[model samples]
Target: MRITVFGATGGIGRLVVQQLLDDGHQVTAVVRTPAKLPLTHSHLTVVTGQLTDHQAVEQAVSGADAVISALGPSLKRSTTGTQVTDRTRTIVQAMEAHKVTRFIGLATPSLADPRDRPHWEHKVLPVAAGLMFPNALAELQGMTEAVTGSGLDYTIARISNPTNKPATGRIRSGFLGHDKVASTMSRADIAAFLVAQLTDSRYRRAMPAISN
Candidate 1:
């Protein structure tokens, strides 16, 4: 598969690229700074550009079989929260133009899934987040709306807090809110799951929570 990755320099995105390469897939890593991704492989092509640039996104996704996005705001409190929603609209347009169907993106669990039966923590946490980080929460909610309405074969993996630990290769994933209470997952495992979705149809057009 020829895959284009947005946010390729990010934590989970880097691992996603490496895992795709390790599995012998062609990878186009779209990023603002090429130097941030140090991995070099015969099958890897780095495309340097901002996600907000339509031409850049189009070029990166031109010949791709699938597009994966790990786009998210930085941890800094001062960051604006609209990047994910804004950039994803561009990606959806680009994908439609190029006739690419598969899209997989990373998302937080704050967005409501229709299949989820809320737990107490799930209920309280989102309310707390809305009260605390209203802008960020709203941005994520908008992003979710965009992807869900894009009319593509999209899967948004609503993940828990990601750690730097090794891949466990064992994850509890479902549309239910209480599938796992650990509320933590390793970045490597998340990458593994995203890469697997390239060919796996089990979760197509579904937003499933994933956790260790």
Candidate 2:
């Protein structure tokens, strides 16, 4: 399988790229700064461009088996809270133009999933995230809306409390308001789950929260 990855320089994103390569899939990493990502492999192709660069994005998305994004929130005060939303919209357009169907992206619990039952964590987490970082929350919510409405085979993995610990490969996936889900998940597990979605159809067009 050939995969195009966005946010390949990020914590979980880097792991996703490496895992994809290790799995023997061809990877096209669209990154702003190629130097930020030091991994080099025969199966990896690094494309230099921002998401806003339509031509470059199109080039990256064209003839790809799937597109995966690990984009996260930007907490900088200068940010207008639409960073992820705007960039994701560009990617969705590129995918549509190129007739690519599969898309896997990341989000937070602040973006509600219809399957989510009324739980204390669902209520409190969004509220606390909003209070602490309003802009960041808005970015995630916007991203969710864009992807869910893009009319593509999409899976939005809503993760929480991403830690830097080693990958346990034991991830608990559930709705935010459920007791089965925990508060923290390692970045490695998150990356593994996201990469696994490339071939997993169980979560197509579904938003499931994951934790460990």
Candidate 3:
């Protein structure tokens, strides 16, 4: 499979790229700073560009089987307020133009899923996030809305707290309130789950909150 990845320089994003290469898939990574992405492989192609650049995004997505994004807003308040949202919109536009359907993007539990039942964490987290990181929360909410409304085969993997621990391959994915999910999951494991979605159809057009 040929894959194109956004946020390739990010923590989980880089791991996603490496995992794709290790799995023998041809990879194209689009990023603003190519130097930040240190991976080099015969099957990996690095394209330097921002996601907002339509032509650059299209060059990355033109012939890919799937597009996965580990992109998220900074925890700190964003000055522009809609950085991730804007980039996600650009990517969606590019994918629509190129007729690419499969899209896997990231979000937090703050983005609600219809399957989510009543839970305290689901209730409190979004409120806390709104008060603490309003810009980031808004950015993710907007990004989620864009992807969900894009009319593509999209899966938004919502993660809980992320740690730097190694991949366990033991991940729990489901709606937040209904599933017994841990509060923290390893970044490596999250990357594995995200990359695995390239072939997994169970979560197509569904947002599954994942944790350890």
**CA shift of 7, model 1, Å:** 0.5
Candidate 2 lDDT score relative to the true structure = 0.89
Q: On a 0 to 1 TM-score scale, where does candidate 1 land against the true structure?
A: 0.94
Measured on C-alpha atoms, candidate 3 has an lDDT of: 0.89
Q: Encode model 2's per-residue lDDT on 11-30: one tens digit a residue.
A: 98899999999999999999
Superposition TM-score, candidate 3 onto the true structure = 0.97
Please, what are the lDDT tens digits per residue for candidate 1 over residues 1-212? 99999989999999999999999999999988989999999999998888789999998889899999988755455667588789888998999999998999977777767777866656776887777777777777777888899888999998758999999988878866546535689999999999999988988998888888
Q: Which pairs of residues have clashing backbones in candidate 1?
A: none
Off by over 4 Å in 2: 177-179
Error of 1 at 26 (Å): 0.3
Top-TM-score candidate index: 3
Which consecutive 10 residues in model 1 have the weakest lDDT in total? 174-183
What is the lDDT for 83 in model 1?
81
Q: Rank the candidates by TM-score, best first.
A: 3, 2, 1
User: CA lDDT, every prediction?
Assistant: 0.86, 0.89, 0.89
Q: Give a tens-digit lDDT track for model 3, residues 1-212.
A: 99999999999999999999999999999988888998889999999887767899988999999999999988876445687999999999889999999999899887778988987877889999989888888889999999999889998989869999988889999987788876689999999999899889989999999988
RMSD to truth, every model: 1.5, 1.2, 1.1
TM-score of each: 0.94, 0.96, 0.97
